[model samples]
Structures are given as structure tokens and as C-alpha cells.
Target: MCSGGFAKCLGITLIPLAVVCVLCNILLFFPGGKVVESDHITDEVWYSGGIFGSGVLMIFPALVFLGLKNNDCCGCCGNESCGRRFAMLSSILFATVGLVGAGYSVIVSAVAIDHGPKCLALEDGKSVWTYPFNTNGYLTDSTMWSKCTEPVGVVSWHLALFSVILIMGLIQIALCAVQVINGLLGALCGDCCGCCGGVSMFSYALDS
Candidate 1:
């Protein structure tokens, strides 16, 4: 496939993934479907990894990739091949931006998953909202989830949504990494199929 077309596909795939990440992060604020004070929320949610890092930052690169195909003759002294190559070259920068954003989301989501959820739990014979599971072993022990007395299954909720963000962030990272390589190939070779056509036409002219 031509690099431009392939990038367009990558761009389309990123949009929905980014949307999912944003939604997951937003839902993290209201653990177990119950709204809580801003201060009571888990600390990782405030990092905005899914919302700002993967979500918003990814939009720019996606858009740039989508527009690459249309740039076949956009600039560069009216040479369609040069114009396409230039567009592909520029996409490398946007891919780098995507890489940074997705990497940030991945790191934050992983940390949040390890830390567990913040909710009301019994401590010292009193009920207070806090990070009930400080150890990573909570993921394997369902009984430990009972520690969060309030928010109605907050442990599960936190784990599910943050897990989604983590997975999606990893996907975004992979796609952006592919784009980096694709962009380089496109810049160096122009559109693959289009180059074949150009070669054919040049040979035909020589034969004539």
C-alpha cells in the first residue's frame, strides 16, 4: 500500500482509540458511578494522561496523517511526487508528538493500576476515604476489595477503566511508532504505487 494511504488508515484508527482513552479517564473521576469531591479522587487521574496526553495530543498527528494523501500535489514547485514526499517527511514530527503523548498515558495508567483505588475504607474503627490497597497483590485477592466500604465497588471500577486506558495507550504507541517508519519510507521513496506508474511512463516515453 502507498504510504499516504496507510497513514490515513492509522489516523482513522487512532481517533476512536483516543476517544476511548478520554472517556475512560473522565469516568475515573467518578469512581463506581458516584461523584466525589475533587480532593478525594485518585491522584493519577489528575495527571490527565488519558485526557491531555493521549487524547488531545494525539488529535494533531491523526489529522496530519489523514491529510497526507490529499497532499500529492500540494506544494514544492508543482511537483506531485516532491509534494507527497515533503508531506510524509513532515508527518515524522507529528508521529514523534504522538509517541510522547501515548508514552505518558501508558506510564500514568500503569502507576494508577498499581496504586489501586481511593475510596472510603474502615481504618482504626473509623470510615475514611483513602487508598485502601497499597500493595499490588490486591489485583489477585477479591476479598481485599471489600476494604473500600463506600463508592460501591470502587476497586473494580478503578481497575477496569484504568486498564482500558493502559491498553489503549499501548495501541496508540504502536501505531505512532509504525507511522514514524512509514513516514520515513514515504519521504525517501514517494508513494510506492505512484512511483511504479511514474517509472512505467518514463520507460514508455523512451520506447516511443
Candidate 2:
């Protein structure tokens, strides 16, 4: 029962949420990878999609932990099943990392749209607006990439809304893992829990 329930939860929840977060990050950061010459995606902070995608990646191990944990509980009759504990702990740990990384992505994107120097914050806390190129000719020179004063064209609020939706879905997906955990515990403890494999009906997988 534990194994069945865990697989159901995973098929329905965790994997799907991670998928969305990864996709949204790709769209937000790359945006066709054109590197808006004017503003927005300055070289100062290539921090959009990458960070969020990494956060999404963190969930993979979590699903594994959850599945093994769930299965052991169901098969063992409450006899020292280690899988449940491992899965619960891993889910919480990885999900927390995902949340933190998501927050950073949001802050960086918001700051980039705010002001140029403010964009400096995402540059690992350095002034990307320096007057001259340091060495690598990317944007160090003030007259070159630094001289870019044009504003990044207004991005669609719809896109931002999509990002929000993606993150929310991510949270829902993480929350769904708890259901698997609960099911495992109930099975071992001889309580009640439901099979949730079909929960994926409402969840969409992240972009490829």
C-alpha cells in the first residue's frame, strides 16, 4: 500500500511541479536568448532561468526518497521501515532549497526591471556599471555594454502571471508529497489513506 500510494503521489504531484518551475525559468531568463541589447537581460545578471531551473532540479531526489519510503512502510508492517523517514526529510530539505532559489530568481528579475545599478545586485554584488571593461570585453567598458541605456521592452504581465502560476503549482506539488508521506505512515500505523495516482489530472509537466 505504501509503495502504491507513494508512486501515485509522485506521478500526480512532485514531478509535475518541478517541471513547471523549470519551464518558467527557461522562458524568463532566455526569452529567446537574444540578450536584449538595450536593457533587461544585461550581462550583469544571467541569473534568471538558471537559478530557478536548478531549484526545480532539487526535487528529483525528493521524489525518490518519498517513493522508497512509502513502499517500505506498506510492505513492512511498521517494522523499522526507514524509507518513510528518509523521504519525508528529503522532501522537506529539497523543497526548501527550491523555494529559496525561486525567491532569488524573483528578486533578480524584479531588480533588473527596476534600475541599471540595482541590476548590479544580481552580479554577485558588484557594480556591473563600471566605466571600463575589466578584461573580458563583455560589458566591462562603459561605452560598450555599460552604455546601453535603452529600456528593455515591456514584458507581458501575462508572462509574469505565468511565472507566478508556475511557482504556485510548484508549491502545490511539494505539498502533494506530504500526502504520500501521510499515506505511508497510515499504512504502517494501520490507519486510513487513499490512493492518489490520479491527482496528476490537474497537474501539468514542466517544459522540456
Candidate 3:
């Protein structure tokens, strides 16, 4: 497949993933699917990692990738093949942006998972909204989840949403990584599959 075609596929795949990440992050604000005071929300939800990092930031690259497949420059100053190559080259920069954004989401989500949920928990015989798990091992210990007294099943809820963000972020990272190489290949070698009169256009672009 032409680099542009592959990029288009990646772009299509990224859109839904980005949307899911955004929704999951938003849901994190309301722990256990119930409305809570702003102060009660987990600190990590405020980071906007999924909303900005994985969602908004990813949209740029996805759109660019989608447009690349139809990039035509018949009336433009440059050769069409050359223009296509340049567009592909430019996509690499956007892909890098995607990489950074997804990486940020992954990091934030992972940290949030490790820290567990902030909920009303017993502290000195008083219930206060706070992170109950001080140790990493709490994730595996279902009995320990009872520490969060106010938001019932909050530990599981927190784990599910953040885990989705983490997985989606990793997928975005992989897709962007693929696009980096694909973009480089597209830049170095004109998109042969999409070129009409094949070798001539590819050769002409290289010769110019």
C-alpha cells in the first residue's frame, strides 16, 4: 500500500481511540459513575492527559494523515509527487506530536493507577477523602479496596477507566510510531502505489 493509504488507515483507527480516551478521562472526574464535589475528584483527572494529550493533540495528526491520501498538486508550483512527499514528511512532525501526547497520557494514567482512588477513608477514626493505598500491592488485594469507604467500589472504577486510558495511550503510541517510519518512507520514496504512470512520476519527482 502507498504510504498515504497506510497513514489514512492509521488516522481512521486513531480517531475512535482518541475519543475513547477523552471520554474515559471525563468519566474519571465522576468516580464510580456518581457526581462528586470538585475537591473529591482524583487529582490526576485534573491533568487533562486524556482530553488534551490523547484526544485534542491526536486530532491534528489524524486529520493530517487522512488528508495526505488525497493530496494533489496539479495546479500548484511543485510536482504532485513532490508535494505528496513533502506532505508525508510533514506528517512525521505531527506524528511526533502524537507520540508526545500519548506518552503523557500513558504516564499520567499509569501514575493514577498506581496511586489508586481518592475517596472517603478512615484516618485516625475519621472518614476523609484521600488516597487509601500507600503501597503498590493494593491493586491485587481486593480486600484492601474497602479502604475507600465513601465511593463504593471506587478502587475498581478507578482502575477500569485509567486502565482504558493507559491501554489506548499505548495503542496511540504504537500507531504514531508506525506513522513516523511510514512518513519517513513516504518522504524518502514517493508514494509509488498511488502514482499514475508509476515510475515516470516517481523518477520525475526525484529528478527535480
Structural similarity to truth (TM-score) of each candidate: 0.91, 0.44, 0.91
Q: Which of the two candidates, 1 or 2, achieves a greater TM-score against the reference? A: 1
Query: How would you encode candidate 2's per-residue C-alpha lDDT over 1-208 as one tens digit per residue?
Result: 4443454455455555556655655555433333444454443245543335434544654464445434444434565434444444445455455445545545554444332321222244543633222333432343434332222222332235344534554464455445445544544543222223333433434321
lDDT of 3 by residue, 106-179 (tens): 99999999998899999999989888799879888898988888777788889999999999999999999999
lDDT of 1: 0.91
Tell me the TM-score of model 3: 0.91
The alpha-carbon RMSD values of the candidates against the true structure, listed in the order shown, are 4.1, 11.8, 5.3
| Pairs of residues at least 3 apart in sequence or in different chains that clash in candidate 3 | none
Ranking by lDDT: 1, 3, 2
| lDDT against the true structure, each candidate | 0.91, 0.43, 0.90
Give Cα distance to truth, residue 33, candidate 2, Å. Answer: 7.6
Error of 2 at 37 (Å): 4.3
lDDT (tens digit, per residue) of candidate 1 on 13-106: 9999999999999999998999899988999999989998899999999999998988865668988889999899999999999999999999
